[model samples]
Target: MVLVSAVRDYISRMLQDISGMKVLILDSHTVSIVSVAYSQSELLQKEVFLVELVDSISKSRESMSHLKAVYFLAPTSENIQYLRRHLVAPRFGEYHLFFSNILKDTQIHILADSDEHEVVQQLQEFYADFVASDPYHFTLNMPSNHIYMLPAVVDHSNLQRFSDRVVDGIAAVFLALKRRPVIRYQRTSDIAKRIAQETAVSTVVYSK
Candidate 1:
């Protein structure tokens, strides 16, 4: 029920089922997610021989067909595209894909089409998508946390991105814990109101 333990358990489940030497792959965001709860030594003890970024792994021409690829990535379009390219030219014996959040149906179809060789052993949404600071607290780790104080018009795109990250982070937390939150935010703050509204929509979108 605690934040760190929940994240740790999800990661344990992801790695424990797949046997043998494996390469743990992570995206920029997922690196934070995993690093907070799972240590490098823990990964090595689990038979993880290597850890590489999603964008970095695709650039290597050398094949690791002897190793099973264990991917822990955020379910973003860019990450999916990188994965699709890897699937098109599989370099591993088997691929176990675990997304940090829900994967849309269209995204699934794209992956299906790109997987011509069908080396993908599994594809699932594990939902360990937030950075847990401790047992009781978590964070999205947004550097632009200050933007919520400024009006949205000051920097529209950055504010939008910030809000979206908040929504995603909130929804991911609820999804990971399998709980529906009863949200209450400050009614006076426009930014808090905006986030509460977006979280409502996003939680609904991802919960199903």
Candidate 2:
């Protein structure tokens, strides 16, 4: 229940203060992040009338000035690009940007610069990046699950990306709880050890 409660609290905080009809914009990854902790009926109760993928949200050229956009997405380059396009020709009256994990300074700068229309009202990091399957079990839902089993030498770039994401997920879990944990991993697995060490560094960095 820890993971579920933490994610639910984050979602509640995001929606509770915002009034009027809202359109929730999620990425492919955040769909799982939200679905695990919330339901469509709960969103409707919060006055969220629409749920849409960031990539698909702009497919319609129609303006929706009555509905505000509440975007909860991972801070990825592709998602950033999609946001840039949306900002250029905004369909919603207001945007509340909430990233699932910590975002780079440059990424924030890029977003701020792109918002020429001043449609964006708020920018925040809520740290509900991983999928909570159960109270004691959570998953990053990594696409390259097989890559983690391979040696770091093979496809070094992808290996590093995988490790970084692992660290991010772990850091986000701790951040959501407002705690900094000393991460431990199995001694037999090099990947686990690497993830733990990186997570420690990331946790410290993000805590500040």
Candidate 3:
């Protein structure tokens, strides 16, 4: 199946069982995830009254206890931190956390520890990580992506950020496919080699 369809299926399944007015919460990355596969009208059709960013959602003290919250986000530290803060005093009645890839157990524990209000109902990993820009080609859209051209010592921070996103996207795709295929990288690209190394490590960990 296509990347869009994979993400759409994950979302459709997330919202299918719950029958009521809902709010869809997304991180910066996940906004693109849902936006590509689903539309504002489609969310409205599913009784999703609001679609807000996780960071933005925390800005208001207004309690939306009437709407169930379905959070779809990348399994990033920032998103986890946001959930920790929100769980301290939840605005939504029920929260269902759907991550885009494998979540660290520590991340789950952190969220669980903060959920004193008992608002979160479920936690799961759904592998729909890559942005499906098109059928034939998909860009990882790694921020600081240009850093791949520099040596590790020259742009360590930016290169790390770039590789993390690329590895995340590739793993997401492979996880979605449930495949273990051999991969190749451009031999000349510095970033490509680094990303390939990271991807290898990720595959080894996830494959086990």
* TM-score of each candidate structure, all chains considered together: 0.92, 0.94, 0.90
Q: Which candidate, 1 or 2, would have the higher lDDT against the true structure?
A: 2
Instruction: Choose the strongest candidate by TM-score.
Output: 2
Clashes of each: 0, 1, 0
Please list all clashing residue pairs in model 1, or write none if there are none. none
lDDT of 3 at 30: 79
Writing each residue's lDDT as its tens digit, candidate 1 over 28-139 gives 8999989989899999889998999998888897988999999999888999899998998899999999998878899999999998998998998976879998988998
Q: Estimate the TM-score for candidate 3.
A: 0.90
For candidate 2, give the lDDT of residue 38: 96
Candidate 2 residues 1-208, lDDT tens each?
9989999999999999999999999999999999989999999999999999988886888999999999999999999989988998998999999999888888898999999999999999978999999886899997658767755557778778888888888888998878889776888888888898988888888789
Better of 1 and 3 by lDDT: 1
Cα TM-score of candidate 2 = 0.94
Higher-ranked by TM-score: 2 or 3: 2
| lDDT (tens digit, per residue) of candidate 3 on 1-208 | 3766777788898888878999999887878878878888988888888889999987888988999999998899999998999899898889999998888899989999999989889998887787777654555656655645755446577557766878888977777667765778889777788778888778777877
